[model samples]
Target: MSKLLGLGIAATGLAHFAAPAAFEPVTKLAFADDIRNWTYRNGATELAIGLAIAAAPTRKAGFAGLAVYAAWLGKRVLARR
Candidate 1:
């Protein structure tokens, strides 16, 4: 389960790097003209988190990734307000 989730995350991250333009629509609303830059940065973060989870499929690593993602989501939510 952990490996599957990690692979999914990693794949998405790789997509961000490989086809950043495809993600423009989603990111454009948040970053505007800096969509490319934002995508790349986000991709790197996602890749790292995914790799971490894959490398260590432990409860601690899972929680760490979840916490990071939750924090990011929280920030986005707060920013929208």
Candidate 2:
């Protein structure tokens, strides 16, 4: 389980970093001109949480990351709802 978690988190973090940067003019402008801000921010944070979870050496770390993820995901869902 630990192995899988570590790999998954590391992979996602690498992927996130490897991906191209957002070419748009304003990341903060999404609220006014685009819907990208909310979506992108949530996606970015989830990856961070994934990295956090993967780096965790114990179940406690996983749980903490999961809690953070839930909170972030919940906010995104609520925003769209």
Candidate 3:
């Protein structure tokens, strides 16, 4: 399960790198002029977290990934307000 989840996350990161332009709109509101760069950085961060989860495949790793994801989600939610 962890491996699958990790792979999914990694795939998403790869998608960001593959088509940063497509993601630009999602971030344009927050990063008007730097959306592309921001997307790339986000992709890199996601890739690292995905790799970490994949390498450990332990409860700790899963929790760590979840925490990071939750933090990201919280940040996005807060930004909307």
Clashes of each: 0, 0, 0
lDDT of 3: 0.73
lDDT of 1 by residue, 1-81 (tens): 777777777788899989998977766655555679988977877777777776664546755876877587567646765
Residue-level lDDT tens digits of model 3 in 1-81: 776777677777888999988878876655555678878877786776776667664547756876977687568756866
**What are the C-alpha RMSDs, in order, of all predicted structures?**
2.4, 5.5, 2.6
**Candidate 3 Cα misplacement greater than 4 A, ranges:** 29-33, 57-62
User: Candidate 2 — worst ten consecutive residues by lDDT sum?
Assistant: 23-32
Query: Which residue pairs in candidate 1 collide?
Result: none
* Model 3 residue 79 distance off true place after TM-score fit, in angstroms: 3.1
How big is the positional error of residue 68 in model 1, measured in Å on the Cα after superposition? 2.2
- Stretches off by above 4 angstroms in model 1 are 57-59
TM-score of each: 0.75, 0.47, 0.72
Candidate order (lDDT)? 1, 3, 2
Model number with the top lDDT: 1
- lDDT, model 1, position 10: 78
Ranking by TM-score: 1, 3, 2
